[model samples]
Target: MSDKKHKTLCAYVEEELQVKDAKSFISLIQPATHFCEGCGRSVAKPEDVCKPKKLK
Candidate 1:
């Protein structure tokens, strides 16, 4: 989706991320530094998620 707003873990496009950017997703998830309070998705950087809450 070209018109997608934010490029966060929670905003991922299934086909786009799975097929094209799966590696990116995997890397973003492991060793995650922050997790989204809104969607429970984790990412390396706070900016990579919607509601980023620091990992304990």
Candidate 2:
């Protein structure tokens, strides 16, 4: 079993935001930074990111 836990993009953002309000959070995430595993950099859209599969 792997010791590392997998988190969605949203989950990772939420952790960075801490206890911010909904409105502020929404505003902050309006332009979310999605990392492209293939390119190894940030992207404009989540679709550009190479998402990992969920372990069943």
Candidate 3:
């Protein structure tokens, strides 16, 4: 039995932000940053990396 907890990338980012270390953390994960590379706009979530399709 192991006593370890797993956290998603977003969860870790949120924790770093809460502790006022978001800038440093952001730099570390910049390659995986979820944003609009076209316009340099930051996205709200990591899942937002992919655009969703609309159904008619």
Candidate 4:
């Protein structure tokens, strides 16, 4: 593996979904999944962000 440290940067993607039983049809924000550049792993949700630190 490379010595490059993996960091979890803040990121998001826009998504649209159909809703049932709506009056005026308002928009909703949903949690999106993101991938890590170093590990190439998928982050579960936006709330659970993995913040990594650099080694001096």
Candidate 5:
């Protein structure tokens, strides 16, 4: 899957799991997904803080 398509916490975790296992995992953890208020980017984990990129 392309990284751009996985724009959510559940999507990231889902990528690491089998189709059969994903449902169970989602139900178990029920992670609180967050989206960046500034750029509308989905934050997969709590530590996913937004940082400015340095231009070359």
Candidate 6:
């Protein structure tokens, strides 16, 4: 691995997707198959969080 961490949902919200991009952000979180073990937030992809765990 490159040892590079994926961009987190929190960072993506604070850095990339802002209030004006709520709709876009929503799309990014839909159909969540996993959740962040560190943050406890559901996300579509494991890469979307700092620490990911399967939804099941």
| Order of candidate numbers by TM-score, starting with the best | 6, 1, 5, 3, 2, 4
Per-residue lDDT for 1-56 in model 6, tens only? 12276667878767657476777678668999889888788889888788889988
- TM-score-wise, the better of 5 and 6 is 6
Candidate 1: residue 28 Cα off by (Å): 1.7
Candidate 4, residue 6: the lDDT equals 31
Worst 10 residues of 5 by lDDT: 47-56
* TM-score of candidate 5 versus the correct structure, residues matched by position: 0.28
Model 5, span 10-34: residue lDDT tens:
4445466436566644543344355
Full-model lDDT for every candidate: 0.77, 0.45, 0.44, 0.30, 0.43, 0.77
Give lDDT tens digits, candidate 2, residues 1-56: 12176434355444654364555445433455655454443434565345632212
- Per-residue lDDT tens digits for candidate 1, residues 1-51, read 354565777667444685687776687688888989998887888987878
Better of 1 and 2 by TM-score: 1
Q: Candidate 3 lDDT, tens digit per residue, 1-56?
A: 02166433445545664357766545534554455444333444444333422211
Q: Which structure is stronger by lDDT: 4 or 6? A: 6
TM-score of 1: 0.70
In candidate 1, list every pair of residues with a backbone clash. Answer: none
TM-score winner = 6
The candidate scoring highest on lDDT is 6
lDDT of 5 at 5: 39
Indicate whether candidate 4 or candidate 5 has the larger TM-score: 5
Question: What ranking emerges by lDDT with the best candidate at the front?
Answer: 6, 1, 2, 3, 5, 4
Q: After superposition, how far is residue 39 of candidate 3 from its true place, in Å?
A: 20
lDDT of 2 at 40: 46
